[model samples]
Each structure stands twice: as C-alpha cells, then as structure tokens.
Target: MQDEKLNPSDETPKPEAGGAEPEFDYIDAEELDRLKAERDEFRDKFMRALADAENSRKRSERDRREAEQYGGSRLARDLLPVHDNLRRALEAISDEQRAQSAALIEGVELTLRELHNVFGKHGITLISPQPGDQFDPQIHQAMFEAPVPGTVAGTVLQCMADGFMLHDRLLRPAQVGVSSNVG
Candidate 1:
C-alpha cells in the first residue's frame, strides 16, 4: 500500500551530482563513419532486393497474360485439318449435285461459315494466296518450285493449303508452289 524509493545501485548509470555533464559514451568519428556506411549498405541491399521482387512480379503477370492469350494455339492447330476437310467436301460437290441436295449443301455451308466466324472471333485468320501473287517466305511454305514461262521468279504459282494466324503469331504457313523464271 506504500510507495518504496528505488536504491541508487539499482538505477542505470547517470550524470553524477557534479555540475559537469557525464561524458556520454564518446563514439569516435571512425566508428560513427563505419556504422553509417554499414547502414547505407544495408539500405542499398534492401532496395535492390525490393526492386528484384517487383520485377519478378511484373514478369509473372506478363507471362500469365500471354499464356491466357495464346493457350489455345495447340488445339487450334490440331483442328485445322477438320476445317480443310470440310472446305474440300463442299468444293467436291458439283453445282448440279449441290442443287439436287439443297438442304444438305445449305447445312454444310452454314456450318462452315459458322466455323469461320468462330475462328475470326478467336483471332484466327487465314493466309490464302491466290495464283500469281508474290511469294512471302514468312507466311508461305514452298512445297515445290517450277520453271514457268512469263511468270516472275519467286511468285506464288499456287496455294495448296492456306495458313492461319493466331493473333500476331503464325499458327501455320500456307503450303504453296513457287515459280522460277524460264527462257
């Protein structure tokens, strides 16, 4: 119930009863500089580590976005043959034959058009080159080269199979025949 005074021996060191201030722990200039240098080095290291972590996070985000954008490339490529076969089936039917089976032809043509629309929505584009168009190696794969009269060298003689692009990337190259100049 009563307050007790603490003994001097129990107290931490302080200035004596003399008017002179106790010599505070005198740190030398060299020690102060060393401590400052150590602090600066640790601060620099911490900043570098922080920057590295930020950069890693940004890279991961970019990679995730790219994966989302291009994740269907493999499946799209695999389904290309189906598209080609469908086109060929329509092409194989003569006009008279198509007229004879008007409903069947209409259904197939509608389905093909729907498929193309789906591809367009997903950023799939064709690279079909007509005859005599200039050949571009970037989007065309030359299946054969032949000498043709009055045709420019490196001109696309024919496109056997059309190419496709998924966004800016090439999904497939157009199968083509190139022409060479002949006398």
Candidate 2:
C-alpha cells in the first residue's frame, strides 16, 4: 500500500506541537463561513430556549404562591356571616338576659373566640374602622351617606359591619355610613 495525496478539503488536522493552534487548511473559506453561520444560529436558538424556560419557571412559581395564599377565599367569605351573627347575638344580650343565661352566653363567647383564633391562624384579619376615621373606599364600602353633626364629609359616620382581609388581598370592605356633611 502507498500513501495517497488528499485534497485540501479532505485533510485531517495534524497533532499539535508546542501548544500551536490546529490548522483549518482542510476547509475552504465558504465552507468555514457556512459552519460559522450555522454555529451562530444554533447559539441564538439555545439562548432563546434558555430564556423561555426561565420565564416559564418564574410564572409557574408565581401561580403556585398565589394559589397557596388566596385559595381559601370562598370559604373565608362564607364564614363571615356566621361571625357577624355571633357578634350580633352577644351584643344584643341585655344585663338581665346575660344574668339569666350566663352559661349560654359564655358558650357563645367561647365559640366566637375559637372562630377568631381560626381566622387569625389562616391570615384572616379584621378591618374595623371607627366612627370619625377617614373613610377609605379601598377598604370601606359606603352603605349610606348621611349628614351628621360636628363631622366633615367623607368621614365614617358609623361602621355598620366590619370588613376582612386575607393576606394582601381584601376579602370584604367594611360596610359603613359616611358623613355627607358639607365642608
């Protein structure tokens, strides 16, 4: 067998000596340019895919956090009326009625306290605005507008019912009567 002469395009790279760079004498200029362009295209696609994957991961994480924080919103809303009724019952008990039904009142109080504890544990918080406080539409609902003595307009005349919040979101706005007193 004899050594055959090879074309420039078909030549294999020789072993490097003294840390010299490998020669690309085997490839024509057009073919080298083509390979460079192909490499650049692949690099661009890889970068875009990496960015998309990162964006998708971030979006999924945000969705999961929101579900964890606000998933029980409906149940929390439904339980509000029960809390309101219990509070009203306690408020309606006169001194004579309280003395006569001490045990029943105590039981109701205990139940309300337990409900409050559960609410606190679940990140439920009360938005109880007092009369004379400035009425904020974000957390307070104007049930009615009425003129009152010694109060400016847009002030809370009365908090008809309390509001609630779960984490950073508002569960319910505090129902209130706003002072319609003209400035």
Candidate 3:
C-alpha cells in the first residue's frame, strides 16, 4: 500500500476533546434507578411468596400428622361395645357356678383375657369407676341419682355401663348412678 498522511484538521476524535466525556448510551440514571426499584420489589414479593408456600406446606404436614394420629378414633369407639359384652359375659357367671366347673370357667376367663389383650394392643383401656369415687362428667354419664345416707353428693354409687378410653380420648362415658344427700 502507498504511504498515506492525514491532516491535523482531520485527526481522530480525542477522549477529552469535548468539554464533557461521552455519555454511555447503554443506560440512563433514571432508567437504572427504575430498573433497580423494579428488581427490588420483585425480589421482595418473590421472597414473601416463597415464605407463604413454606408455611402452607408446614400446615399441611401438621394436618396430615394429626389425621394419622386420630384416624382410628371412630373404629376404636365402635369396638368399645365388643369389650363391654365380653366383660358382661364374664360377670354373668356366678362364683359357685365357676367353682362347680373350674375348667369351663377357666376357659371363659382365658377368652376374656385374650379379648382384653387385643384391646390393649390397639390402645383401648377400661375406665372402671369405684364406688364413693367422685363422679366426673367428662367420663361418667349419670343414669340416676339416689340418696345414699352418708355418701357425698355426685359420688358414683354404681357404674351401670363401664367407660372406656382409646388413647387419651374417651371412647365412651361410663353410665353411672350418683348418690345425693337428699331423699
């Protein structure tokens, strides 16, 4: 190529030729501030949404655990009648009759014991109320009230139907007779 020379008047533009440096066209201060604000707002909203989703998940897990823990409550309540019947049958046999046929009585006793074992295995428990014990409305249903001379009022005079519990919850309240100080 031939040697070429440029005039000073046609020289390339210098960095500071103008009084001010060339402004960057890529982003203006107003646009940058608006974009940053938008980004910050979106970030805050996303974090909040994520936290809400986590809370919802935790709530669902708690509900599921509660359901699993108490799922058999209804079935356990229904099984209470079977336990009652078994107890009643054992109670029906007199001591004299039991002594007369020890083998037969033993067989009945064994069967009753097995039934109770099954109940315990499934978290079923008997609520045997004692005479003179304070009656509790939560676990005792008063069938009748009678005056029993020296007994305190609201004392359990008799348990007509035994109560039962499945876990800590009452499956059935005891049908009971209370004693009062009046005629």
1-183 per-residue lDDT for model 1 (tens digits): 789899988987666799566776989999999999999999999999999999999999999988987999999999899889888999899989987999998998998899899899888998999999989989999999999898989999988899999999999999999998753
Q: Which residue ranges in model 3 land beyond 4 Å of their true spot?
A: 1-33
List ranges where model 2 is wrong by over 4 Å: 1-25
Local distance difference test, each candidate: 0.92, 0.95, 0.85
Per-residue lDDT value at 150 in model 2? 86
TM-score of each: 0.83, 0.84, 0.71
lDDT string, candidate 2, 8-69, tens digits = 99976676886676765688899999999999999999999999999999999999999998
- Model 1 residue 124 CA deviation (Å) reads 1.0
Between candidates 1 and 3, name the one with more favorable lDDT. 1
Clashing pairs in 2: none
* Worst-scoring 10-residue span by lDDT in model 1: 13-22
Better candidate by lDDT, 1 or 2? 2
Q: lDDT by residue for model 3 over 44-162, one digit each (tens)? A: 99999999999999999999976775677898778777777867877898888878988987877788788788878877788889898999999999999999898889899998888
Q: Which candidate number maximizes lDDT?
A: 2
How many clashing residue pairs are found in candidate 1? 0
* Backbone clashes counted, model 3: 0
Error of 2 at 55 (Å): 1.2
